[model samples]
Target: MTARIGVVTFPGSLDDRDTQRAIRVAGAEPVALWHKDKDLKQVDAVVLCGGFSYGDYLRAGAIARFSPVMDTLIDQAKAGLPVLGICNGFQILTEAHLLPGGMLGNDHLHFICRDQKLRVENAGTAWTSDYSAGQEIHIPLKNMDGRYVADPRTLDELEAEGRVAFRYLDVNPNGSLNDIAGITNAAGNVVGLMPHPEHAVEPLIGTGRTDGLPFFTSILKKLVNA
Candidate 1:
């Protein structure tokens, strides 16, 4: 059966359509989910698309974390449902305590937008299985509070357990601790990253690079084999 992937559209979300398109391009059915809805439509996985959710009030993603959908998402995620959070969605994941750490202001104290290079550190996660360890890919990055910070022990734990799924390459765009660009939960079912993979899935579009397509494909492969 073809995988059905849900893309959640919180208020201020900018990439929900693109994410759904990417899922469809990957040979999966794209289901649109709303922030206020409790039902998931039985999607095999979920993607929290990026944007300035809730206008970034009280910190990015702070308000959206309490959305009705998140209540269900949190429970399902703990039960082994796969989730991928990108950009502002990453912030929400952290705020919801689904992922670790907090997103702080960029070290430069400015909104940044650029094509970023990242190294795949963990290829075994539900969202990254299509990548190979140490492989490098370029994706777009944009955000003001994009820096990732965590206590020393937590950082150590993430590194030691191979939970650091992606690391910035060449240059750190946001001064994230340990140059971490993304991380996965211990179960490998929840993954969050600052870079915008949904924006890079089509080669004919921005940057003409399709490096981000694997994220969708990886989940499709997992669901098919399951």
Candidate 2:
């Protein structure tokens, strides 16, 4: 069975097409979802790709949290629909309260872009099953407000519950608490991360590594086997 995944495109989304290509490369159909629409196109899963949605002027992903598409996306996500949010998409997830924490400007006060190393801390999430716990991988990372922050109580809860799905390696690029690069919802169906996995899916691309392909493949496998 072929899984159809929806990729939401906000007005200022920069990586929608690339994410769509990655979905196709994973042997799934990519469904383009517009910001003004609430219908999900009956997709089995959804991805909110990296971008400066609605122009990150007032804060990344703040405006996108209210998009018509997100109305349904939020509801469906709560019902166990698999969702993966990357970069600004991660910011949106926090705003929507689908995931914990908010993003702040990098501690260095500058946008950083490079191939980043990450350690998979929880490989059981819907988007991470193809990887093993403690596995290390490289993916492209680029962001301005990328530092993840949360209340101390929330951080303790997440750590205790194994919700921290990935952590920065080599360097904590954004000074996020606990070196968090990604996290998952308690249900393991929703995930948010800062790195651009879609960019590293093909070996001929960025770092000549396909470390990110497993994300798309993992979701496809989950949906097909379910």
Candidate 3:
């Protein structure tokens, strides 16, 4: 059966449509899921696309964490449902406590937008199974509050547990502690990242690079072979 992936749209979502298109291009069915809706529509997976949800009010993703849909998502994620959060979506995951750590303002105190180089540190997660460990890829990353920070103990645990999925390859753009770019939960079902993979899936658009296609494709392959 073809995999059905849900792309959520919050009040101020900017990449929902782009994410939906990328899902289709990745050979999966794109199911549009509203932030208020509590149903997953039986999607095989879920993608929380980037954008300034709730206008970044009350500290980015702080307000949207209590949405009705999140109530179900949190429970489902703990039960092994695969969920991918990109950019602001990453903020939401952290806010919901699905992913650990916090994203503060960029170290430079300015909004940043550019193609970023990332090293795939852990490919064991449901969303990154297609990538090889230590593989490098370029994807677009744009956000004002993208610096990832965690207490010393949590940081040590993440590194020791192999939970750090992606790390900034070159100059760490946001001064994230340890150059962390993305991480997965202990169960490997939940993942959150700062870059925009949906924006890099199509070779004809943006930077003309399709390095991000593996994220969607990896999930599809897993669901199909399961």
In angstroms, the error of model 2 at 96 is: 0.5
Per-residue CA lDDT of candidate 3, range 85-121, in tens?
Answer: 9999999999999999999999999999999999999
Q: Which portions of model 3 show Cα errors greater than 4 Å?
A: none
Model 2, runs deviating above 4 Å: none
lDDT (10s digit) by residue, model 2, range 1-226: 6999999999899999999999999999999999999999999999999989988978889999999999999999999999999999999999999998899999999999999999999999999999999999999999999999999999999999999999999999999999999999999999999999999888888889999999999999999999
Q: Estimate the overall C-alpha local distance difference test score of candidate 3.
A: 0.93
Clashes of each: 0, 0, 0
Please provide, for model 1 over 98-140, each residue's C-alpha lDDT reduced to its tens digit, 9 standing for 90 to 100. Answer: 9989999999999999999999999999999999999999999
Tell me the whole-model lDDT of each prediction, alpha carbons only.
0.95, 0.96, 0.93
Q: Extract clashing residue pairs from model 1.
A: none
Q: lDDT of model 3 at residue 59?
A: 85
Candidate 2: global Cα-lDDT?
Answer: 0.96
- Model 2 misses residue 140 by how many Å? 0.4
So what's the TM-score on candidate 3?
Answer: 0.98
